[model samples]
Target chain A: MVKKFMALLRMKYIEMFAYQWATLAWSTGAMVQPIITMMVWINIYETEMESFILYFSTLILVERLTAAWDVWDLDRDIREGSFSNYILRPIHPIHWAIAENIIYKGLFLVVLVPAWLVSSFFLPSLQLHLNGWEWMLFISALLLGGGIRFMFSYSCGLLGFWINKVTAVYAMFEGISLFFSGRIAPFSLLPPIMQDISLYLPFRYMIGFPIEVITGSVKGADLGYGFLGAFIWVLIFMGILGFLWHAGLKKNQAVGG
Target chain B: MSIVVDHLNKQFKVHVRQAGWLDAFRSIFKREYQIVEAVNNLSFTIQSGEIVGFLGPNGAGKTTAMKMLAGLLHPTSGAITVEGFIPQEQKAEYKKMMSLVMGQKSQLIWDIPPMETFLVNKAIYEIDDNSFNKTLDELVALLELEPLLNKPTRSLSLGQRMKCELAAALLHRPKVLFLDEPTIGLDVDTQEKVRRFIANYNREHKTTILLTSHYMGDVTALCKRVIIINHGKLLYDGDLDVLTEKLTPYKLLEVHLPTLPNQSWETYGEVDSIEEGKVTLRIPRERIREVSARLLQEFPVHDLNIQDPPMEEVITLAFQEKSHG
Candidate 1:
């Protein structure tokens, strides 16, 4: 399995290079919304520019790290029947998607980490101050966040077996996630009720909770609860993914085969 | 038997919608569905190392059956066991032992060279480096893929991409290969090359191959046995020669004569066509010898020949019989 995963990672890396422009465009373009949101908040608050800058920059990094395109891929492949190529292979099809995620996110880190360091040298707000344990906890939250988002997108993609317009459904979910996952604002700035609601929902864990961890807004029992909520959501999404995979295979018409 | 399909069946629930916006909107609220029986109670067995042609016309459930055999779709009912493994179960060992190639649906990564796809399969199938190298070398030589290996799949011609697709699918050395229209849309020369490669590969590897093709030449060249189906029903399954002989129990007699006959030739046999001094007759197989002799004696025959009906004609008759029955 490890050998196969490495091979898949290598293949996906090469594929990324083949579409270098698209990869660059996507990885860079995704930052625009958060950066724009950051500017708006900075102007509106007038005094909290540094914190707002830190918040949105970290959001950009965390969002890119957790981004998943499997829904779009699955929607097209399953509908067009090219997905059967993966299905018929000895390895499970999900491994390919997972490998792709690892490679793309690894690339994002490689590009964004240096960019963040350089920006921090210019703008001190971009610099993070945290102890070793805090850094470890933040990294754990980021990985968990990525896992949640991947499972959610992949599960939504599996819906393509039953529905022709699965991407639209996923788009609706993504729009909801925008507000709930703290992309537009920090989780701490949300209205009290919304913050309470975000605690129980998985979307918050996908992007918001990780940002909260790094921003130092989630500490003490809230930090414990954040990890607990994130872990629970991971299990829930993993369960959903498992059920969807098995059911989707049975539902699969293997269209165009 | 390398493959055994016992009463295998697959049915799809397809939405039925009419044209126009109102109907589409109504369908969104209240959709109707019809059950499409893509494959129904199909039972057939193929022995190990046998290359059997799966013959069918458009929408004849050929691809559906192949997909079921390849474990790409779940059968609505019944069962399919390929190499002692139930295909729908999709066990890893079962998958390791079989491969499927759909000419219309490519497995090759479009933007990358096919070698990358081969390497990916090597890992997915856990093929040792030695075996992977050996098999790839053999396939590359046989398919003449030395130059094409490094080119992007999208840049290569359809024939070249198909050769790469074949090579990629075979890198695992599967024991049973399910080919759905493997040579579709290729030129005659490329089709012949694919056919020869399939035949030679089957011969060398003793792999069980179940192939479906619209082109009769593919079947005639590579498969002595064929299984014919239509409307998800098995119409015929046996030797290709036997099916032809059974469907068309007559031989075509062509006579090259110095002059045309004046009287009706109905007394001898059914006149299929006549042009100038050349006459063609459909004579019963039992009487072909007698008819040929009489034609030679009376018709000023220069040369005469007897031949079975073409495979296309025989297969058409088989389908017609099923439909008309």
Candidate 2:
């Protein structure tokens, strides 16, 4: 099983390489929203302009790592009958999606790390003061956040098995996530009610909480809450993922190609 | 037996809607659905090492039956066991023992050479290195895929790609194979080659095969026993020759004469066609021998030949009879 997974991962990596330009274009496009948010906040918030800049820059990096677009691919596969290839095999189809997610993140990091480093030199406010333990927790939080986000999005994708167009559903979820997950503004900047809602929901753990951890904004008891929230959300999404996978397979039409 | 399907039935709940903006809009809230019986109470057993041709016209449930046997679709009611394993359960052991190749659907990775897909299948099926290499070598040699293995699947011709598809399906050495229109659109030469390859492979491996093809030549060449279905019901299941004989009771006899005879040819047999010096007659099968001898004695017969009706004609007649009833 491990050998098969590794092979799938390698195959996805090769496939990603074939679309290297498209990957670069998408990553570049992803940076624009965070950059625009930072620009607007810098002009409006005179007192915390530098800190906002630092936070949004880190948010861009974290967003790139945690993004999962497998729902679109899954929807297409179900509609076009390509999913039969995976179904006919001995392996579950989710492994292919997982491999694709891992490859996309790995390839994005290749273009991101160097860019982050070079931009940090130019942007003095980007520097962070983090202890060793804090750095470790931040890395762990990133992995958990990515996992939660992937499972959550993939669960939404599984809705394709029931509905004809999942994109509208995914778009609605994404629209809500954009505001609650700190894409447009920091969680602290939201209304207290919205902030409270974000803390309880999985969206904060998916993107914002991990960024807060790395930026030293979340610490002490809140740091533990951040980790716990992300871990619990991962567990919750994992449960939902299992149920959705079973139900989706049962409902699969296996429509003609 | 390699496969046993008893009282198998499959029904699909298809949404019924008429064209028009109002109906389409109303369907969103309260859609009407009709149940379509794709395979109805179908039953057949295929023995080990036996090649059976599954014959049907479009929408005849042949593909649906095959899908149920391959474990891709669940039967609404009935039982199907392939190689002593329940197919719908989709056990790994069962999957490893059988393979399905759909000529219309490709399992190969289009952007990469077929070898990559083969390697992936190797891992999925857990074929050991030695067995993988040996089986791949044999398949390559048998299918003449030496030159096509390295080219990207997208670049290969349709015939070349189909050979690779077959190789990919057989890499694990499955005991039972379900082929759905495996030679649908290939040229005549390529079709002949694929038919020969299937025959030789079946002979050597004793692998049971259930094939569905519209081309009668494919069925006639590789299969002796054929099971036919129409409207999700079994029409016939026995020897191909027997089905042909049962559906068509007449043989065609063409006689070439030194010149056009002055007498009416209807007295000999029903004149199907006549040109300058040749006349084709449809004669009853029982009187074929007697009529030929009499014709040889009665006229200046240059040459005479007797042939059974084509398999396509027999199958069409069978379907027509069933539909009319």
lDDT of each: 0.92, 0.88
Task: Point out the worst 10-residue segment of candidate 2 chain B by lDDT.
Answer: B260-269
User: Compared with the true structure, what per-residue lDDT tens digits does model 2 show for residues B1-325?
Assistant: 8899999999989999999999999998998999999999999999999999999889999988888888778888999999899887878888888899998889998888898899889999999999999999998998899999888789999999999999999999999999999997899998999999999989999999999999999999999999989989998899998887888888999999989867788877899889999999999899999999999998889999898888899889878988888
Query: Which ranges in model 2 have alpha carbons more than 4 Å from their true place?
Result: B257-263, B275-277, B298-303
- All candidates' TM-scores? 0.97, 0.96
TM-score chain B for all models: 0.94, 0.95
Model 1 C-alpha lDDT per residue in residues B204-242, reported as the tens digit of each score: 999999999989999999999999999999999999999
DockQ per candidate: 0.88, 0.58
True contacts kept of 2: 0.34
Which of the numbered candidates is closest to the native, going by highest lDDT? 1
Provide the clash count, candidate 1: 0
**Native-referenced DockQ of model 1:** 0.88
lDDT of 2 at B135: 93
Model 1 spans with C-alpha error above 4 angstroms: B257-267, B275-277, B298-303
